[model samples]
Target: MITRTFSHLVLALIVFIWIVPFVALVSTSLRSETEAKTSGFWTAFTPTVLGHRFSTHDKGSTVEFIEMSGNIFDRLNGEKSGFLVSGEVQSILIKARIMNPDKPGKTKLIRKLVPAGEPFETRGGSLVFQSNGDFTWTFPEATAPKPKKLDVFINQDPIFGADAYIEVLFDNKNVPNALISSFIVTIPATIIPITIAAFAAYAFAWMQFPGRDWLFVLVVSLMVVPTQLAFLPILQGFSGIASWATALNAWLTDCEINDSCQVASKSFPSLWITHTAFGLPLAIYLLRNYIVGLPKELLQSARIDGASHLQIFTRIIIPLSVPALASFSIFQFLWVWNDLIVALYIGPNNASDLVFPIRLQKQLGTFKDQLHLLNASAVISMIVPVIVFLSMQRYFIRGLLAGSVKGG
Candidate 1:
């Protein structure tokens, strides 16, 4: 009993810790601006609708009540008099009534008895009345409008649907731009580092060289350096390169004969170079460790067979290192995809050059009144990361042992 209880407690605690952040994010995303400012989502169930009472002033006269439901502007749709009545019909009393001319025998009266003490005021249209008795009614201003009902897979609350997700995803323009910029940085960042590192790793493991240990040590030391400290200098350098490119463009445009050629050649190769530089040290270290652990007999036999270093690397080492490479690629891709700071510093922020993450971040600021779109954007930003993780999971599992055993 004690063991079972302990296990249950552990499981419950784990579940709670995992679920809490997700719950909070969802709740906050669902809350309206007014609700968010006034109270939390926990208080959503409290009734927000208001009520008012309407009574006839004339004694001994019966008043018929009718209810109408539609958009506020639709109140005037079928009425003979387009004018809406509001404010006090007399001192200390307001009147609200809807006109119904269809009834032949009796005068039709409509009064909505809302929650008392409601402070909303009607606008643009009024409730018309053809009552025998003088009547008074009071109402509060309309609350925020609810979304149209949608029925899909058990009627998900509008707050939890695509709209809400988009709002969260695109809440900031920087977010989407960041996502795209991450991809731009990651794909080449992963490929360039791995390619160079593979060659270096092969040489370090197989080729005898003076100061190899010292060189490896230098590479590893870079990993310990704080990335935050390096950011400003890197950013300044990138800005200098961009400035140079702009100057070059101005020079090219000054030459009328080849202005179009210069415009066509304006790609920022520096972006890729920066990512590769930042990623290279780690890549070389990881691939070197994996390559050095390969079976020496296989390499020796290849040498005896007169295979060149290039041939051995291409035919043997490269094929064997797929799992390690795949794992590293996934990591690099995700790292770049989620990066906003690096993209902001390295790339242009104008519409033509804006990345997906940046676009999502901009959307977030404008989403105060557009909850649905915000939710959709949130979901869009999450898609690539989720897909990448799922696709690369197998390689990650397999790559753990790539460098662990020599020939096991």
Candidate 2:
């Protein structure tokens, strides 16, 4: 009983660890930038106090005015601005900094909470800031001060929406294109390898051939080899092929030699072939292990009924092996979908062909401060793989555990 309880506790802890980051990621994606940055994701559903700096209108040296009147919320840039929001602020704090006359370029900052519906005094002025966001500033001097900006902090309910997703997905051309390009790259990369491996696995399991066991061992042994070791040789091979193709195309067409006529070494076909080659070793290994565990009577009965190998494979093997195929499909799909190094090395360099990982990586460098958009992009990239896994989850365990035990 104690051991079982301990095991359940461990599993619960593991689940919680996995869930926290996803919860935070989703929460941060939905929140306003200010709310996301200012407070932890735990505070996303609560009222938040957001600080904003707004530049006041300076009427210039010629215009003399002791007082300035406007609504503080008027400075907010509405929905277009990532952080700024306009509403009736129930509580507020005002902060201002003025240059010290004694020290050039040095300033002192003042922060004070305003009484409800009452005027607040500052070092530079007396301010009446209301919950409705209206404010009046009367300066001690004859004219408004230099620099002409004030910081206002207001408390309000958090803003939550799909606005971040909209900006990340539709507003940015790279993200949307990268998404489509990822699907294009991943789908073929997955199917071609599975198709080829299924035929190979069936042969290794059922057919008679010279050095069959030795060849199966050789393929299975390849699963231990790091793909990085083959990169240099494979890349050189691709470059050579592309160069030859480019020369042939140039000779065939009467156009000047340029990228337009040059074959891209990192095209979609190259990516599919690379993924297929790398995936085949494991795909074959898994499917062969599972197929070998099937009832021999099934195959013999088909053979006795005058069924050929191809007929038995298509009619009997394929249908019965759905669980194993689905299992390998999930593995291959996720691997290809999430791959970055392979994409970065042999993948397309053109803007139109960049995958989600590369585009997301570029966004990391370009929009380091835009966490909201980054989080949204991360979530978007995970959506397809998650859907694929969930849809095929029932078959995952059954297929993966194939050959581990035999039925009586």
Candidate 3:
């Protein structure tokens, strides 16, 4: 009983830790700017309305109280200069003003307006003018008013619905493009590396040749080299290719082959080559180990039956190594798909060529005011990674032991 109780407690604690951040993110996403600024999301359950007293010295203490649903600025919709009068006051006038920061006594009137018996509409909140010129704003009111019900829309309040997902998928361009680019980069990157590496791994494992062990060791050593060390060299190589392509185009105008030769060009092709190069070392190492572990009897029997190396590799080795191949493909696909560093470095910096991460970063400005959009963008970026992880997870476990033993 004690052990069971302890297990339950641990499970509950783990669940709480896991859920807290997600709850907070959801709450923050749904919270209005005012709520986020003033109180925690937990406090939102017990709501409060802002109350303002509208009165003037000339009005002789006939004060009007206004209950508002939201922040003060929201109630004064673009009108800064205004006298707080009784709701019964006809021809109510209000003026919008900005307090001068440099000059204390001076007020700059930005706008003037007459109360139209309607309050300004904002997300999750509404402004209502009392019979006196005093206006009160309310948000998600405890009891909605009767007769003419006021609908308050508070912007930036946390919503507990699937709207977050919808907004991320449809509204966010970066996420979608990132997802698409991931697929584009991943599919070709995975397929090309696996195809080439499978052939190389087969030769290294089955074919006897001088310096084979040394070559394999060198390839494996390349794996330990930090990827960052190659960045500048790769960049320079691509830049050189771009330069060569430009010069070749100029020369093509003078060549007889110009009519038949289409310029075999694009940064994308180069990026594909780069991904293949980076992926090849690991792919070969993994597949070589798996292939070398396969039964030598199968290859010998196929050879006695007059099977060429090509025939044996194609017919026996490939059929048996499906798991290893699948596993490697999954690994390469996911790595290439989620790679922002490579894409950013190789991709064109312009909007037309910008990948998902760059586009998401573009949404976030240098100032704090752009935080709402930044939050929205962050949610957008996570969608593709989630999808990729879910789709490829099965291969991880299923293929690890594949081709290691003779029988399944």
Candidate 4:
């Protein structure tokens, strides 16, 4: 009982460790740009003090007395999602240049706080401030002091909204297209490999063939080979196929006449094939391990009833291997969904064809200061993988356990 309690505590701790970053990511994504930058996600629910720097309007050499009256909050960068929910002035500091007490005939610049709800007299103006961020300034006649900079601090209630998500999904053209492109690339890339691997794995587990064990061993050995090593040859092969297809199309139709032929190397089929080829070794290995563990009596009974190998595979093996297939599907779907390196190397180069990872990466450079949008994009990217895993979680555990030991 004590050991079980301790194990539960350890599991809870591990879950908490995993959940913290996701909570922070979600909190940051839901906040305004000001809130995201000024405070950590932990401080998101409480009131926060944020500082802003702005200047009074310049009169520009006019010798007339003028009054400047405006809400100091208006000087903030225009974010209209009620970001300054119930804002009040916490403090204000005004810049001033004064004669240096230590150096003769020299001046230095300094800032001093303007007391709340009080008129503070300046060299050119007298200013009155309010806690709600309203301010009035009356300048003396013929005094043209340069625009004085004011550093204002405000205490504001927290506000949360979907502005970041809206911008990421709708405002950015590439993001929406990249989302479609990701679905287009991921679905086929996942299904094709699993379909092919199932057949190969069943053959290795049940079928009688010459050199079957040797072939299965060779396939398993391929799991250790780095994908990078095959890049050159695969690319060359794809390029050759593309060139031949292009020439054939050009000769047979108006493609060359209209100058409309496209190189097939950078299309969706090429990417699907590349991912399928790379994923096959592991897929077959895992499926074979699981399939080998199936009840041998079921297969023998099917054969005794005069069922062919194909019929037994379709009628018996495929039905019983659901757990394993679903498990591998989750793995392949997540991998292809999050893949940037493979897609960038062999996938389409056009803007409309770029995947989510490449598009999200470009946002880092293009919208460097818009981190809220980036966080929103990151969260959006995780949604599909989370759904895939959750849907198949029951099978995942079963598949791992069943595949661990083979049946006689």
Model 2 CA lDDT for position 302:
97
TM-score of structure candidate 2:
0.85
Per-candidate local distance difference test: 0.56, 0.83, 0.61, 0.85
Q: What would the per-residue lDDT of candidate 1 be over residues 20-119, giving only the tens digit for each residue?
A: 7555555555554433444544544443321122322233434432322332222211352321222221111233445556865555544443222233
Least well predicted 10-residue stretch by lDDT in candidate 2: 78-87
Q: How accurate is candidate 1 locally (lDDT)?
A: 0.56
Give the per-residue lDDT of model 2 (tens digit) for 1-408. 999999999999999999999998998998877677778888777776777766555345466568877776776663365545765655455666879788899998866665547876654677677777777778878764653466666666677888889888777788999999999999999999999999999999999999999999999899998989989998999999999998898889865744467788988899999999999999998888888888899999999999999999999989988999999999999999889999999999899889999998999887787788888999999899999999999999999898345321
Candidate 4 accuracy as lDDT: 0.85
CA deviation > 4 Å runs, candidate 2: 53-111, 121-127, 130-150, 257-260, 403-408
Best-first order by TM-score: 4, 2, 1, 3
lDDT of 4 at 387: 91
Tens digits of per-residue lDDT for model 3, 308-404: 9999889998898787887787778667765778877775554555556666666555324433344555655555556765776676565566533
After superposing candidate 1 on the true structure, give the runs of residues whose Cα lies further than 4 Å from its correct spot: 1-182, 239-268, 369-372, 401-408
Ranking by lDDT: 4, 2, 3, 1
lDDT head-to-head 1 vs 3, winner: 3
What are the TM-scores, per candidate, against the unseen true structure? Answer: 0.61, 0.85, 0.60, 0.85
